[model samples]
Target: MQEIKERFKELRKELKLNQSEFGKRLAVSKDVISNIEIGRVQPKTLLIDAICDTFKVNKDWLVNGSGNMFNDSKENVELEELLYKISKENSSLYPTVLKLSQLDSESLVLIDSLLDKILKK
Candidate 1:
């Protein structure tokens, strides 16, 4: 089993973020990040989520050290990070999208087509 220090070092480096900068994204102090990296602290669930999402880390791997650290490429990781941030602010978006999907095939296709068009432009 990897110690917290080794896991922390690998994760931060894989994300290409400095500890202080990563801490800022997770809304934690640098000292908190330092403590986690050096085995002085065990991060809570919320903090773990923040860190994992911000760095595109695999949650299971972080917790148990059993899988790849990151599951996405650099660009995809950044996009996922952005989406996670948006998720926090727009908690209703998922429910709204789900409701919209329950309408009809035509409505779903229309929405999907519209999104595709916008994405292509």
Candidate 2:
């Protein structure tokens, strides 16, 4: 299992937040964050949930290191789940989705416009 203190430190660093700033986001004092990070005290469940939700962290990964570090937004998670199901049903589509995932936002917008035009025909 992942140590909460270690994961808290990692999350703080990843977000480029100092203890004070991180604590502000969680509505806690800097001392509280410092204490949690140092293993001086366990954070409350509300604090843990706040950390996960506010930072888009995977609760399982934060708690047990059992999955991806970040959780996608609801829309993204839904889309990904749909794609996974589709990919399983039609394996060839998986590569296309993989390639699409590599495209930057601008490129994706261009592709979307082109696809819209094609579909309109």
Candidate 3:
């Protein structure tokens, strides 16, 4: 559990997010993040799931520290961070990204095909 807490803080630092920013993404308070990081409070399963889902964290690595920290490449993580910023400002691209993220593999393949045709690429 202590190791998991440390990994939680490490993941936040790797994402270049402060406690408050990280908490905001997880819908938690900064104090909750602080307490968990300091081993003062045990992190709940729901909070863990939120962290993993929001940041694409590997649950195995977050809980047992066995695999890579992130399920996606660092580039994907950076893109997600950018999307978060865009969402805060209510950018048109934010909704597009949100919708794109929810698409299934088949839909994504269709979208890719359409994009390649439209772009002549």
Candidate 4:
């Protein structure tokens, strides 16, 4: 079986975020990340959202440590799931939507147009 902590350490290095920075984003201390990475603690399922959110990690990749780090998507299904999970984990996303809401009517309209374009893929 692939060890999650090892996978996490590998991916973290790939993202170029030091443990302190990554833990800060995940709302945990660097020691927490270090503990997990060093096999001092095993992460739980609830941490999944936080982990994925902070790292922009592929959940399937983290959970199973299998397949491409990137998953192939068809029908926008994967993207929709990714967005929903990310939005759920990050409360700031609501503020992001609100910030986008501040855009003028034409800009907001263009944003919607862009989303429609993506969804149509």
The candidate that achieves the highest TM-score relative to the unseen native structure? 3
Q: What local lDDT score does residue 96 receive in model 4, on the 0 to 100 scale?
A: 78
Q: Is candidate 2 or 4 superior in TM-score?
A: 2
TM-score of 2: 0.58
- Name the TM-score of candidate 4: 0.55
lDDT for each residue of candidate 3 in 1-121, tens digit (9 for 90 to 100) = 4498899899999999999999988888999999999999989999999988888999999999888999999899999788878887877777688799999999999999999999994
List the candidate 1 regions with Cα displacement exceeding 4 Å. Answer: 78-121
lDDT of 1: 0.79
lDDT of each: 0.79, 0.83, 0.91, 0.74
* Model 2, span 1-121: residue lDDT tens: 5698999998888766799978987889999999988999998889989988777789988888778777976566446547756997899998899999999999999999999999999
**TM-score of each candidate structure, all chains considered together:** 0.59, 0.58, 0.75, 0.55
Candidate 1: give the clashing pairs: none
- 10 residues in a row with least lDDT, candidate 1: 78-87
In terms of TM-score, how similar is model 1 to the real structure?
0.59
Tell how far residue 28 is off in model 3, in angstroms.
0.7
Predicted model with the maximum lDDT: 3
lDDT of 2 at 18: 91
Query: Per-residue lDDT tens digits of candidate 4, residues 1-121?
Result: 8788888888678656799976776778899999999989988777767776544567888878877553334324355455656787897787876687589999989999999999999
